[model samples]
Target chain A: MQTEQITETQKENKKQSTWRTAVSALLIFIAVPATIYLGWKFADRQHYIVSLLIILYSMVPFFLMYEKRKPQARELVVIAVMCAIAVVSRAAFIWAPHFKPMTAIVMITGIAFGATAGFLTGAVSGFVSNFIFGQGVWTPWQMFAAGIAGFLAGILMHKGILKKKRLHLCIFGGLTVMLIVGPLLDTSALFTMASGISWESARLIYLSGLPVNAIHATATVLTLFFFSKPMLEKLDRIKLKYGMMGD
Target chain B: MDDAFSGYHPAVNFIFFIGAIVFGMFFTHSAFLCASVFTSMLYYLLLMGRKGIKLLCTMLMLFFALSFINPLLNTQGDTVLFTYIGERPFTLEALMYGFVTGGMFVSVLLWFACYNCIMTSDKFIYLFGWCIPTISLLLSMVLRMVPNFKVKIMTIAGARKCVGKAPVNGDKKEKLQNSMDMLSVLTSWALEGAVVTADSMRSRGYGSGKQSNFSIYRPSVRDMAAGIIMLFCIVLTIICAALGGMEVAYFPVFILPEANIITILGVIGYTAFLLLPSIIHIWEEATWNILRSRI
Candidate 1:
């Protein structure tokens, strides 16, 4: 009878997990594209609104998945701690514009905890830091860029393509910031501040962002080179001591 | 000084800002842009006082820079003001478009500055907590942790200083290394403390059932009145915009909308909405002065 009950509970858990998987897939594959299509169709000229909606929609699946998991308090605390570190580090380095260890710390969180935790750390850091730096139209874009960086870091680490070594992590961090986060933010500048969406204006925006992106990328690479090992070890120690955030 | 507008319900504050920012972003008509930039500057000044002047000057610089750059990049207009290198003709239409765009961007920035002052974090959490409990809880936790970590880091640095190991003075690379060491130490301390915090939270039955949120905000009759007025203005302006009353064209030629009744009403609505907070503050100041004099 005990064995039967255990199997029954397992079956129920399996069903719930499958349902969640389906819902997340639907949100990502169907809802996101539908939103982009409709937003483009109706709000052709309103680039800011359209892009903002697309970002908000794309983020829904991650939040939904996280909420559905019913994460433990320890898990939440770990994510919060990562976010706080990112924000604090950004604040600590305020004198050096574009040279923030925030992205590097966020990537470490991803490499240590997992993708979801990493994303949350990045997004929350982007948001809370804006409280100090002053929120603007760039807030959402910054959040999205950082979150994606964390997400990619988590995925690559999980796939073994991104090793924990200093050289590997530094290269990954530099490339991610320059290729992904930088362009995403520059795109926001184009959509929000630029008058028109011509190729010329877009090129100008991207070119203007290059110097800032280079500085940011250098910061990330330096941070990862010096800090990733000890930070990862510390995170591993916490997980081992508390036996939490293993998943 | 306390802002009278901020005393309203959080929803009212959020609605007003959303309206102001959205309209400011979407509208490109020169009249509407002028109203937006002017009112946003006024409200920002009211919110920030003299400290805002420096930022306003920076914003003006940004506005001029953006306005100047736009004509150089976009050479699509008919009226050529001048030709630069590579036969790139700078057009008057592009310059005007640039000015309108720059005005919109600056106004949005100013409105956001005012919003940062008015809508504090607790209010933001209160407004969204019920609908998104998990995210809101996470947001609050992160916000709580940021300051906590800052204090902890300072303490750690102080402790390090007592040991003569603080990163106070060094060459650039050495300073970077010292800071990184400090960060690593802080991370370990923070992570260890976090486990205790999580355990304490768990002991308090945090995830046992649906969590309850507490807030001090309660909408009153005055808030209701403010909400109604804001909604009426927003709806009127949106309707006017939908009816093509706020239409503007910039490419190839510049065309401003005719001064029709609907367009005028839309502009008035837009201006009134943007000016609401400043008006409330000014009125409150006057009333306070009168009451003080009587007293």
Candidate 2:
């Protein structure tokens, strides 16, 4: 009789789960059409809003999972701030033309903090800084490209490529990223902005990006190799002082 | 970042999901100019209400600085600002165009920031997962992969340091060697992890002939009603856009025949309609909580 009761409970749970799945399916069906329709409507208006919406939308699934995987507020704030700083610093190089230095800072941030932080920093910086010059559909890709640079660096650190003293290797990797991934990102942006097939335009954009990319990589390598461990240690001390880092 | 992935209002997520697609379709045209200006101001107001407006201000300042400086450096415009040492052109037109473009760019970014602040990532998955399980799963895996990859990097770096060859600040050759080593380790681990995941998923019949099922949070009747209204708004907006009722152009002189009085009203009406779901849901929840408190 007890075994039968347990089986009955199981059946009830299955029924409930099935109901949940059906509702979820219906919501998805509604969402896709709405997205496409909205896209068609907003097309040729404020391109930035679209980008803003996507970045914001990307946050939704994570938010839904928050209760099961709670994130610390302090961590989010730090990541946001770090990203803001990284992007702004890169923008500053537009005047001074320093590529290596900025990249190093980005790399260090990623290596020490982790990929999400790197992504946040890269994305936030790109988006925020771009707003000053002009905004369009290209912003997300710019954010993705720059942020991914830091993200990849962080991943390398995870795999043991970046270390406390491996300055040269980190620098080499940073340069390789510029030559390879950097141009491709710029190309994609140009392609999206207009169907301009001009090699000249592509070359111009790529050339313009070179200095900034170099600065970013060089700065990232230097900071990652030298200051990261110490700075991270200092951050830990600050956390301890403020009672921010949770056990 | 405890809240890095939490507290997304469903209403906000829905707004953004539709909003992004709109941006994707219309970014190249001149109407984007007007939309950029209008939305920038709206975004500023939205941020101000949230008491998080300083971020927008900071970003705007940067935009101004970049627009002005970019022209000076590039020296490629027609209406020259001043002759430099090489007689390089710095057109007033380019600077002005850049400024408008820059403003548009920043406004969009601020919009995204606002979105990020309000909407968490999980809602994105829940909204998309039911219809597109394969893509949703891939996204989920990517998110999880980030932290996992970080852990592995730290572990390997520590292990290498112990074995001595800790070339953090080495010559170019040493740096090259270390990078390659790191890549090799990362690639192997990633491949292994992918294989394991595939095997595990197959065991559970993830991609078998049988249709898969997912358990998710249930939407109330109110949620369904809200969803319907949003869909209606989306359709209306598309019609408005397609009919050219929303188009705006500038630089042959900024004009928007699409922004006729009737079309403007329609746009406003549809937007309100889209927002009805959120307003209703919030009101219902408040009433329920209040009654529960009284009891």
Candidate 3:
């Protein structure tokens, strides 16, 4: 009688588990295809859905890794700030003698903050700016590239690879980033915008745009050099006022 | 490490994240047409399935609305769809074109939405963090800062309103002044923030060049496999995209209708690969949980 009861209980548990698995799997399959198809159809008119999805997707890895740290008020504030700066910076790019180098600014901000903060700044800046300037597939690339740049700065700063005072170090690092990785982003944008242009031609176009690229690098370094000291001083004052960080 | 973020490896996130963006960059020209077809198929496949015929009908309704409204407003096409206000002749070709273009436009936006869902900001940072530190750091800061700035603006704006000197709406000058005021406040705050950060860094021996350590998240075998698949898909997509497999230029001519096999194949291949990982992960997780529960 005891053996029978145990078997019965085990069977019930297995049945329930199977049911749950099937339901979850079905839901995922349904959700994935539905999103892609719906997203594909309304992609032009209602691109917000995609952006919404991306924002939601970001929470996935976060959720998977940590059960306790929920998205919060303070964190939301940071996301908003990064977005605004990104927009402003992109707009500023249009006005710069060439294009105001923004990677440095984003990098600096990320270093000061943390990883998520840095990534958001770059991503948001690219996103907001693109929305204002143009609405194309290239916008996502910009967001990713710019965001990556900022995120890199944060990680390196954390690791002591990048320093505040070493303007040359920052500039060289920023330039190297642009020269190697920048091309891929440039090519991506070009391919999307003007697909007819051969990859070779696209490379030439990007190469020709070197002046603008240089300006971007120079502007970034100069801005950092001029602002870092004052900014640090002010940050110190804020820390004192808020007592957020101990001396 | 201190519990600010989960232990998800930034490196894997970055790789996939960039891959996603690169994927997105493949869809620039056919914006309207491609988006339209993709969205229709998406809605039908995801929602209606074999009964997608009903969804297609709904899609037609949407297409009619967009195309009809578009030419009436845009009036750029050479072929007239109809006569709107007497002198304004809307050509049939134009209306149809508009309809297709509108569909494309909508579809492209939807595709981006899906792309965003798959590739996120976290992934972007993780991939590129090592190569470009300062920029990456600043980006993160900006992400955090944008929200901060918004709060400050709202608070200041609210306080001003309460004082009966509301600075919400006005002419350019007033708006400029309001912005200037905001900038002043922001600058003051930023300066203060900078000082604190520098002090913190200095104390932490940031520039000490002691080969500071970072909690690197090495890619697991699964992650590597996933990365390889993503890279391969992107490469194939680019090649196809470059060969005009996806291009459908309007005005002079409208080539490659949805019925075209090559175009259909490209669309299918791209969509399938794009959504592959998420599908697999979701499936695997469900299975794992079920087995665990059973145990």
Candidate 4:
């Protein structure tokens, strides 16, 4: 049965490969130059193009997770739930300015599910939570920031960097999430929302973000330290019993 | 409340959102940025009344703090304001740049709140549905799921409070345990609902074949007209930007571009775009008031 399922998925993948290659070629040869031309035509069009590209490129992973895997209904539901949980966890810590549990949740989702699932969780949560926090030009930046953390987490898990040792995971998760959310998000703000300041002044803001980034890192570590083990164990058992994706 | 802007086709609202966000962030000219800020404040007051004013005050405080911090850390410009430590010069250029940057930030931030008021989730789903249906389905579900999770958590907390296990009334350790218990309960509850959703979706043939979109928004003649107006405004704004009519160079020295006729025309077009919803709102309110008084 497993072999049959694998073959079916492989056939589906083969069928789509032609169009996939065509789309990528179009992006490379035509779409990219066109975007650049439009960007050069305007004064501050580069940031919008860059952000729109991140989301559009993220489609590769989105396809890998859904179309390639042909994830079962149950797995899709689980991924969506993980996204909801991550968003609510961020709100759960709303009183704390820089302490964000959503990063830890994204890390756990990536570690437990896979990188694709992790990226989706982070991106979805970032996008959804802005409804409460208010959506702006920074919404895409937040999505990219959180999504990178999850994508990195998946790489860590695949490479056995996340194996057994909880301390290593905490340290790595803290630093990566903070770096992405702090410096990256800060710079995006400078470029997209507040480019009146010089690049040097922008760098100053990034440097000053260190303290808050440290707090964010600490929150990731503490949340994961307390909660990740049980969640991972549960996910493992679910995979074993139900043959879920990433099993 | 049934707002006037929300009554438009979702595409129209989305176009306006794109216009406002792009134009608000794109132009760095002091007059343009100030106009954006002023319009944002006006819309915010119309949207959230006193709460919006409070946010405006907060943004002002942040602006001054950022301005002060900029000259202290970044001594890059020519016109020195004051010197800190031994040699670092607080330049007038840096200060003005900081002020303008702060204005840009506040304007974008207020526009976001304004977006929240105008572009409801239904509107968002309607916008994305045609292009990426599955993703929009997931997004709309997520929109529903977030508020549902909050309400469910509150219910769980209320139930726990009755049992003397609520996080609110307990000592340190107990409160910690209660919060954990609440999280775990929420996790389980979510998992249960997810499974049910999965089954229902499967039974209903979620991924069977190409499915048509179920959109509640339709493009009226008014939407078409409004779309053309927005497109014209955007084209005008872009031409103005490309012509360097809205230039405000602040690197070596703070400078405001000359507000010539072309720049003034661009400003009018852009202001009209940003305040389109507000205009619709005022028109609706005035007509309603007139009708009521006649009655």
lDDT, candidate 2, A72-115, per-residue tens: 43444344434434433332222223433334545556666666
Model 4 ranges off by over 4 Å: A1-70, A90-99, A178-181, A189-204, B81-84, B155-165, B168-174, B251-259
- Cα lDDT tens digits, model 3, A1-247, are 8888768756754664555455445545665567667556533222334443443344323222211222222333334443564454433222224445356556655666655556666666776555345435566566666666666776877788777676744574457455734764665534333212444546555976576566666666654555455544554454466553231
Candidate 4's TM-score: 0.85
The positional error of residue B168 in candidate 1, measured at the CA in angstroms, is 2.9
| Regions of model 3 farther than 4 Å from truth | A1-247, B1-66, B69-80, B84-89, B114-120, B146-190, B208-216, B241-265, B281-295
Chain B vs. true chain B: TM-score per candidate: 0.96, 0.63, 0.59, 0.90
lDDT digits (tens) for residues B185-218 of candidate 4: 7877887788889889989987654546767777
Candidate 3 docking class:
incorrect
How close to the true structure is residue A191 of candidate 2, measured as C-alpha lDDT? 42
User: Model 2, range B1-295, lDDT digits (tens) per residue?
Assistant: 2221123346545564446434423443344444544554454444345455666677768678756755554444455658777777766754654555565456555555545544444565666665444434444454455445556656656676677644353565564445435433543455445545555655775533323434354666755665566666667655666676756543333344645764765466454553343344455557878999999
TM-score against truth, every candidate: 0.92, 0.50, 0.44, 0.85
Q: A1-247, model 4: which lDDT tens digit per residue?
A: 8888768856755766555666656766777677667665654435544555554554444543444455677788888888888788654443346657888888888888888888778888888888878787777778877887888898788988667468877887777866676777777656654334566757766777777778778888877877677667766766676677845
Better of 1 and 2 by DockQ: 1
Output the worst ten-in-a-row residue range by lDDT, candidate 4 chain B: B172-181
User: Taking the candidates in order, what DockQ does each have?
Assistant: 0.55, 0.06, 0.06, 0.40
**Candidate 1 local lDDT, A1-247, one digit each (tens):** 8888768756765676677678778877888788667545433247866676678667767776776677889988888888888989864453356679999999999999888878878888899999888888888889989999999999998989988889999999999999999999999999988888989889988999999999999999999999998898888878887888766
**Which lDDT value does model 1 have at B173?**
78
| Candidate 3 structure, TM-score to reference | 0.44
Classified by CAPRI criteria, candidate 2 counts as incorrect
